[model samples]
Target: MPDGDVNAHRRIPRPAWDVINQLALRRCTDETHSVRFRRGSEITRWTLAELDQRAVNLARRLHATGVRVADRVGVLSTNRIEWVLLDLAVLKLGGVTVAVEPGRFEPERVIEKYGLRRLFAEGETSRDAVQDIDSVLSLTEPPGTDVPELPAFPGYDEADICQIKQTSGSTGTPRGIETTAVSVNSSISEVQELFRHGDGDNILVLLPLWFLQQRWWFYSALVFGHDVALSGYEDAVEMAQAVSPTVVMGVPRLYDDLRARIRASGAPVDLPERRETIQALLGGRIRYLWTGSAPATRATLEFFNDAEVPLYEGYGLNETCIVAKNHPGAFRLGSVGQVLPNKTIRFDRDGVLVIASHHPVNTRYTWCNPGDNQKVWLPTGEIKTYDLGHVDDDGFLWIHGRVDDVISPSAGPNVLLPPIETLLRGLPGVHECAVYGRAVRFLTAIVSPNPDLDPAVLSDRIVALNETLRPEQRVHAVIVAAEQFSVRNGLLNTQFKLKRRQIEERFARELELVYDKHNGDAAPPVPPVLVFG
Candidate 1:
């Protein structure tokens, strides 16, 4: 354990570990209805004791296959009972579990980064890139065989590494973010303190457990001895009704989709019966909703407020494990809450956010690339967050956008593209917009105009709208015919964050022509320039 020196993040104490172990043991006994999930039309329930024993069995099997303490084992599957089982088993045996996001598998990179010795798949489709793995294990029964029996393993210490989560890799290549058992326990404790839960609480999980954020909720519930309800990829209304969870965690977009669906279906968004059901599940649960992984829009926040359900929003990254959250007594509708207890947050001269907390710091895992640390750190001890935001007078935090996207080249004053785009996207004719500056001189916008609007009218209206901006911030021209930004098109990342560099690279030729036209070079004699729209 690192000493609590000014230079080092403090380590977890022994008593915390003991408490976690005892909690896990007690919770294991209550597993009779600990987990409930649906397979087609069949509903399966498992007690906490059953889950514990299954994890022990899986741990023994994994150890027999040469897994050891600190070794990385990868699970590439969707959310299911087996996923949690394998995860707990790995943790119990002192092995680190790395969850592979569905549809975002990079086999070669996984092997190279994590040195995974064993890989588990839920189905054959998930084994598409299994060639790099040393051994592959199936969670379900093989074609003609029953599920393989796993052996039990000896006990594990609380200080052992539990999981190594890969960063979302929105900026560059991904790197393994190591999380120790003690840190996970601390995170779980923090959650239990803020969001009260008990054995009677029934929680619903919809976000992919592979995400570090969602995993916190899972462990928190488990630590609090709460029952967990799992659902397949179903519509929001079905999930809400079937799970009847008192507490739910979802991304901003998911909440938006749910609100839209509930409204469109004309279902009672906040029926008293459903509210009471949710409240009972959380042991008098006061709040039933939370949004993260991206900014929650004012419209989405107000939707829940109007429906009379308590929805709190928070902000964090894989590195810090949810440092700030909005609690029932400390929530502001649009803010991402205040800086959490025992954490310090500050801003640099350029307005980029920085965070320093008790969470473990990874000196070896380089997720952001060769110069990532330099980009996210200053000469001071704080870690550069890359996010741009400010704390309000009342201590609420408001994240504006990424500092990288808000560029100020020597040619002009600062230009914040994201905020501009946010406003533009809300305009009547605009569908989506990506604003970027090129060659340090001109500003350009790659826009996907609303399909329902007339193209000629939209183009003309957009041109007229640009006149409202200062000349430097004005759009040089609008690329109106471009397709909607998507991951498959190399325009969005796995987290649905826009890939600005990719979009710029894809539109290089058109940008060059635009630059030339502005610089007095002969303009290309073309109209309705497609530019691979």
Candidate 2:
């Protein structure tokens, strides 16, 4: 069967609500347009028609099992074709799909909190997490013909809440955010125009499918008729080699680690050769890379750009989808890029960035901690972001740090931690770092060094970093953390943002020691600063 040349011939863009019909049309007419994924040694491909059929079948089965319109159905799984199928199936039945991370949050709690009647668990871990649930189903189940046929498109409205998701919580707790079909569809439309995704373009999704952005890429594939290869972090590089993907969407940590690995491989001295090497490292058909969710170090960004690979960084939240992004046609080196067409951003008097959209994804939290709603949602229909940043004259958005993360040292002036922490992360031997100083004479840092980094080298790097900073912003001493900060340790959130308050409390004594040592000549001895390679 030949690939249907529908995109070039279409006169009107179909809304996301019509995605099932579109898939049916494509499957029957455009046979070659399909979703592809890898699982272990086997690879599976499902045509648009096949995908739509499976979704319809699943929807019928779900309906028979008492799942109804507006019911919240939980999906806890890894990145696989089944996840997409289940998502489509739920949408077809006009049910809201609640995406839940398998290990990060307790499944029972989420089920009770969201009033989910049933859960679709894929992997063993996810299944185990919901063992006690009354109506847990397997996402890996094959489509059955026993159920009656369902309507191709149910009574789904664009304004109805179709999904509930939580952005990575820096506070170690998930806050559910409501999403509508209109918002998701609008986002896809904006992205399609901004990036111009077409045939032969494949976006390799390495992040968990539970994330909204990852699923957005999948929906885009269905709408624009491109390929999307889903894989876990462990097999991202291997899967890339197999698929030769043109676009790879990932978090900043993945890029940072890749940069480190490239440098470790003894990169070429020549710039062109280095660029070629980097491209070849990722299967040789590279178009561009997308990074967000956390800050990518200057060194990591520079490394890819210096190699001539454009790494596009975007800014958004679960509450606001994508606010701004750096695309192929327009970009600024240090900025997240110009605000998207529908969204507008402005800075407050205190330098906090606030966002307002004509069609906001959400206006209130579906589930969150107490008082969280009043803090962010304003009467003007603008979201008051606590992030401190400024827009350049040309409208490029540059983020400095969170407003609350400012370190007010007693003596000279206040300092922003993110920019400094970004610099420290780029320093050799430092894997991760957090800078802090509150009503103190000098700033102190908690450093997580690479295992192979030498202590002497780290000391030298810190000294060199201080030379480039203002007197007040310089870190006077560092307390080397015993372990790397990660989601498992409660030091970092799911999105890789540092839990500043938790990290500070976790190492209170060491911080106190470093502060006391730098206070005066008669203070206690300074803790040894150990650096890892």
**lDDT per prediction?**
0.62, 0.74
Please provide, for model 1 over 205-294, each residue's C-alpha lDDT reduced to its tens digit, 9 standing for 90 to 100: 766678765655456555557777776434434655655667776666555555554444454545664454434433344346877777
Query: Any residue pairs clashing in model 2, and if so which?
Result: 27-49, 450-532, 450-533, 452-533, 453-532, 453-533
Q: How many steric clashes does model 2 contain?
A: 6
TM-score for each candidate, following the candidate numbering: 0.77, 0.89
Best by lDDT: 2
lDDT score, residue 229, model 2? 81
Query: What lDDT score is found at residue 417 in candidate 1?
Result: 78
